[model samples]
Target: MKKGENTRKHIISKAAELFNQKGYAGSSMSDITELTGIKKGGIYRHFASKDEIALEAYNYAGSIVGGHIQEAIRQQETAFGKLLSYLRVYVNVVEEPPFIGGCPLLNAAVECDDGHPILRQRAQQGLEGTLGNIKAIIMQGIESGEFKADIDVDALATFTLSIMEGSVMMSKLEGDNRHVRMNIENFSAYLRAVCVQN
Candidate 1:
């Protein structure tokens, strides 16, 4: 990468960790500069404003997490396996988060809920893509005869995301991956029994 583009990405990477952990509202330009070891002028030179930096950081964080999950899911051989692999990512995230704070989507969604319309929209768009991936996996299972044809794809996808996100939250709070592991295992087994083919 060019020197300028490299500097821009460096700012985004550091800011993403800061904003993900401290939140956009909580993190300030001072904090960003301290974390990135760059002067305010240096940062502003690359980003028009803090908002621009935050948006780029959010996108970077999302892609980091998404790529991790997508790579894992791709390793699976069947649609049912892919669905289980998808849920398993959260279990891994409980301890080894792709970013410093945690799940960027969850953090952004909660932090942006009442304010930061642009960031909230970014979170929403990221979540829709996530849910859409789940639905697509379910549809693939049905088409491949790997999953029961009668499954309600929409409801299952929504429920899966909700429960998985909730589990991650609990795990983060307690500083233990056991809760997430149990939840993922039980849910995966349940789906295997009822949804997956014999």
Candidate 2:
């Protein structure tokens, strides 16, 4: 890659780690400079401000989690397996640190709040996109007669996401992964229960 492109990518990558660990408000320009071993003015050449870096970091972290789910779904043969796979993916993700802190999107939601509108919107969009993917898979199951026709795909999708997010928050705050595991299991059980055929 070109020198400038490499520098920009490096800044975004290092900034993502700091933002994920310290959050937007907690991460300062000097912190990023120290971590990256780059001067503050050097960072400015790549990013206008901390907010710009935060937005990019949020997007960068979000892409990692989103890509995992999408890959899991793509690998499954049926919608039944896909939904289960999605939940399983969440289970595995939470067991790992950083992710164990929960989803970047959820973290960004609470961190950004009213202070950063762009970051907040990115979080919202990330969540909405995740829900939509789940809803689509549920709809597919319904069409294939695997899931009950009466199942409200949208409602169930939202509920499933809510449980995961809530459990993640609890796990992070409590410094335990048990709640997250239990929550994912509950989601899996619910999926099996709602299916037309076992």
Candidate 3:
């Protein structure tokens, strides 16, 4: 990569960690400079404003987490396996997150709501993408005869995302992975029960 591109990525990487951990409002230009060792003028050389950095950082964080989940899903052979893999990824996130903070989508959504419209919209897009992936997996399972035909893909996808996000939040707040693990186990059981018998 070019020198300027490398600097831009460095800024985004450092800024993403700060934003994910301290949040957009909590993280300032000084914090970014301190974390990245880049001057305010240098940061501005790449990003026009803090909002621009926040948006890019949000996208960067989302990509990191999303790529991790996608890789896990790709390793599975079946839709049911992929679904379980998806749940397992979130469970793992409670212990070893892809980013410094927990789920970026949840963090950004909570922090940006009613404050930063752009960041909030980005978070929403990340969530919708996740929901779409889950729904697609369930649809695949149904078409492949692995899951019951009567199952509600949209509702289940929403439920799965909600449970995982809530569990992650609870676990992060309490500094315990039990909540996430238990919820994931329960979700896995639900999937197995719903799956068609071979």
Candidate 4:
């Protein structure tokens, strides 16, 4: 890549790690300069302010997490397979996180809530996109006769999202992967319960 472009990418990447781990408000321009090893003027030349960096960093972090789910689900033909693949991403994340910190959406939601409006919106956008993907899969199953016709699409999708994100929070809090494994098992059974069963 070109020099400026490479620098911009590096700043976003390192800033993503800093903001994600340190929280947006918790991180400062000097902190970014220090972490990025870029001078204040050098950083300013690339980004207008910390707000711009936070937005870009969140998007950068979000793309990694979102890309994994989309990529995994795309590998499956059936809705159940797709859904299972989505769950597996969470399980896989316990071992291989998508980025420097854990799930950006989860971290952003927690850190950005009630403040940091831009980051909050970005996180919300990421979540809505994910929920839409999950709901679309459920809808596809309904149309394809894979899932039950009477399945509560929104409820199931919401439950799956809650389970995934909540389990991630608990697992991270306790520093244990078993929480994810156990939740994945129960959620997997829940998925089976919603299927046509024949």
Candidate 5:
């Protein structure tokens, strides 16, 4: 990458960390500048405003978490395994220090609310993609006779997402991953309950 691109990425990465920790409204350009060790002019050269930086940061964070889950789901051959992989990846993320910041989409969604239109939209898109992936796995399971036909995949996906995000939020707020693990266990239970006998 060019020097300019590298600097821009550096700014976005640092901004993402800050935005994840302190939130959009709570974060400032000065914070980004200080954390990235980039001067004000350098920051302005990359991003027009803090809002733009926050939006890009939020998008980057979402992509990071979402991509991890997608890869995990795709790697498993069976629907049951995929579901388990989906839930397990979160636990793994929590175990890893880097992704331990919790769900970035959840963090941005909660922080943005109705305030940040662009960031909120990106967050919503990220969540919709997540829920859709889970729902697809459930649908595949049902089609394969591994899950009951009567199961509400959409509702189950939504519920599972809620539980997962909630658990991550709680765990991060409390500085522990125990709650996240418990929530993943509960998701596994929910999956088993919905799965049909082969």
Candidate 6:
């Protein structure tokens, strides 16, 4: 990569964790500089404003989590296994997060809901993408005769995502992983019960 590209990526990597942890509104230019060891001029030369950086940082963080989940899903052979792998990723996140903070989508959605339109839209896209993935898995399972045909894919995907996100929030707030594990265990059971017998 070129020098400028490297510098830009460096800024995004450093700022992603800060934004995910402190949030867009909470993380300041000085914080970015401190974290990245880049001066205000350096950061500005790459990003026009903090909002630009925040958006990129949010994308970067989301991509990391997304990549990890995709990899995990790929490791499973069956659709039911893939779905469980998806949930397992988040359960693991509650114990050992891939990034510094928790789920970037949840954080950005909560923090940017009222103020930052761009960030909120980005978060919305991330969430929609996640729902799409889950829906695809459910559809695949149905086609393969692994899941019931009558299942509501859209509603189930939304509910599953909601449960995972809620579990993450609760775990983060209480600094405990028990509730997250419990939720995942229950979700796994639900998946097993819903799966068609071979």
Cα RMSDs, all models: 1.3, 2.0, 1.4, 1.5, 2.0, 1.3
RMSD of 2: 2.0
Q: Between candidates 1 and 5, which one is better according to TM-score?
A: 1
TM-score of 1: 0.95
- Candidate 5 lDDT, tens digit per residue, 105-169? 87888988888888888888888887888898888888988888888888878887777777776
Error of 6 at 83 (Å): 1.5
lDDT tens digits, residues 19-127, model 6?
A: 9988888888999999999999999999999999998999999999888889988899888778766557767565588667988999999999989998899888998
lDDT per residue for candidate 3 within 73-112, as digits (tens), equals 8999788778766557766565687678988899999998
Per-residue lDDT tens digits for candidate 1, residues 138-190, read 99989989889999999888877887788788888888887778887888878
Candidate 3's TM-score reads 0.95
Question: Can you give the lDDT of residue 115 in candidate 5?
Answer: 88
| lDDT (Cα, tens digit) per residue for candidate 4, span 1-198 | 899999999999999999878888889888988988999999989989889988899899888877887888889999888876656777745567666677888899999899888888888898898889889999999999888898888898888888888877787777777777888788778778656446
- Could you tell which candidate, 4 or 5, scores higher by lDDT? 4
Judge candidate 4 at residue 75 and give its lDDT: 90
- The residue pairs in collision within model 4 are none
**Worst lDDT window (10 residues) for model 1?**
86-95
lDDT of 4 at 85: 65
Clashing pairs in 6: none
> Clash pairs of candidate 1?
none
lDDT of 3: 0.86
